[model samples]
Target: MATKTWKIEKDLCRCCHGEGAFNNLAEPRTFLDKVEVYSDMLRECLDIDIPPVPGELCAITYTICNACIARLRDACNFKKQVQDCEQRFMTLYYKNAIQGLKPATKVKEEIEVSIEHAQSDTDADIVLKKEDEDDDDDNHFLGGDDDDGMSDDDLPIKPPKQSVSTMKTRPKPKPKPKAPPVVKKLKPPPKPKKAEPKPAKEKKGEEKEEFTLTVGADGKERFTCKACGKSFNLKPLFTQHYRHVHLKLRPKLRSCHLCNEKVLPWLRPFHMEECHGLPAPSCGACGRKFAFPGQVARHQKFFHMGESAHSCEPCDLKFKSRSEYNHHLIKHGDVKAYKCELCDKMYKWKRGLRMHMLVHNNIRRHVCHVCQEAFFQQSSLKYHQMKKHPETV
Candidate 1:
């Protein structure tokens, strides 16, 4: 495998302009050493993979400053406080800056201390080897077995001589003084301090209100409003309170068609339904009365409803359906199409033809069977039959 050497580019930090310690632009050897130490420490402790760059030497030229690093560190530390300082630092650095590099990997700091200890032991072993080499050199300097040796019996002995009087007399040895005995003064252990009582916390200005359901003696459920804590027997009152207070809506009134009484617009149909004795909606085409607007709609749909009512622009005559209107539009061939039932004397619409036919058939009356009610128009006879003899019909 090839050897790789890491290099950091001298880029001025954008945040601090190369003034802060985080600025990698500084070329000081001490600063670089410290950075390498910290980086290696973090890599080992946090399992952080250094961002790899291609080539034998890689230069880091990123744009994060010391202030941001410190902030990110505090943010991660406050949430993940650990006993180990190196591990805590690594966790902070890796979580914010390098989490994208490798996810869900953990590291430890204890192994770094062991590595330093091993390095020191290696250095100590080298010193011991050098000392042993020096000792071996000293032994080689002494006489060895290869050197010439005299016979052991032929060796001569030196005679002992008496001390000379001319030598300078040695001074008598002085009596040695002894050290004073140490007096250890023992002190009493400190007394434990009493814990002070904490102050009570202040209450908030606004209190949260709760709404609950309560059963009454009448075996009916009552609703309570969260705002006022008041109980309402009727659900409408509860709804009104919610709309009036919470929604802040004003009550709107509308006049009822049946009784000419002012009522809530939403309740007008119900009022018409309940007030049967009051004046009801009367059909203009058939002269029939209904109790409510819904009933009138049903009556119109079942009795007189058509595809589309068409009226002639020239004669003001209305046709019940689109087919009849189209048939009657041929009189003013340029403007409409109209057909006459009695004769070829085409008019703009059927009404003009009917008016002209009235001269021929003037007796327009229908007699009812049960009441013998005779009316000039068929609609009048129908009204009489439905109102006077409704059960017989």
Candidate 2:
């Protein structure tokens, strides 16, 4: 059985800037010492990418303590709640205050004018009623002459004249002035002229030809460039060839700045985020950052704890994880299964054969940033760049 070993350098915690609170390895002297030990064991995940290479040690994984993890969680939760509240408030204000006052809903000026006119009409009616009551009281006081010689049957009768104050006439509506009719000038009819002949568009060489492709008996897709007329089986190779050689443009596939991985220019950020250890999940048991949570869980269960649920029948090797056990099962009859299609070459592992096939296809996927040199294998390019260009490294 092959045993994998890892060495973690003794460094101060990134959060507390001190070694774990536990002073003795045998036992904890105080409650704070135990808490410190727990803090050292528990770690929060970061958003970084870990290297795919096995046995590669990363130093940045175990910097944060568990105490800081709790604080960070509480802070993030509070921030999210505040943001949600603010968003709800803004939505309500827009619906009730801003959107309600839009011209499409109600006219502010017309409402104000109508309210003012209604107040004036009400005030005028009240003033006229008070004047009419005052005039009636005055007439009754002057006509009460019963003590002199006037009898009830000999009183002089007079016709009542229409008083302006007594009669309540409605205000006449002012007539709206007629607007002047718009005089639209008639445009003269366009003069008929002889039609000029349209020039024929010249066909471009690139657009004129169609891509010619053929399928082999092996059921592999093959493509031929229309511009250069070069035949290729692999789509990636053909695309790279068409872009650089035929189109006279640089290939869109960019090499990773840190590693020899090649990816599209647009996908560079995503590839770097997942491949490099920027902010990746770290294992609580061992300070190893992984690309995913499942990876860290597997590492904690298998490496640090050594708790295996399954064991191989033939080899008697125990595995805590399902993927590791399945991989071990494949090694029981690990014959040379992978074979090269172009040449009489066979490899025990599929990855080895896949790397070997790149040579036959003549696909140089890895490119060095310093010298702009390309290589068929990533390992070769990595070693070449490191050795040849030590200054860049």
Model 1 C-alpha lDDT per residue in residues 257-351, reported as the tens digit of each score: 33558887445535745773323455668977643444555456546864234788888777656787777777657642355566666666656
| Model 1 stretches with alpha carbons more than 4 Å out | 1-211, 255-262, 266-278, 282-295, 299-393
lDDT of 2 by residue, 1-393 (tens): 999974444533445645443122111122422222222122222322322222332243334444654664565557668889999989776445433232333323322122212234566678677877887998787754578778655878776565664455565455455455555565665565544655866533342244565544333446887776777877667766765676667746756646889987445545756787444346666566654444555576678877668888787788776898877776677577788877878787787897787687666667787877878777888799889998876
Q: List the residue pairs that clash in candidate 2.
A: 46-279, 46-280, 47-279, 47-280, 48-278, 48-279, 48-280, 49-276, 49-277
Instruction: Provide the lDDT at 309 for model 2.
Output: 85
Which structure among the candidates has the greatest TM-score?
A: 2
What residue runs in model 2 are displaced by over 4 Å at the alpha carbon? Answer: 1-305, 312-317, 329-334
Clash count per candidate: 7, 9
Task: Compute the lDDT of residue 376 as modeled in candidate 1.
Answer: 51
Best by lDDT: 2
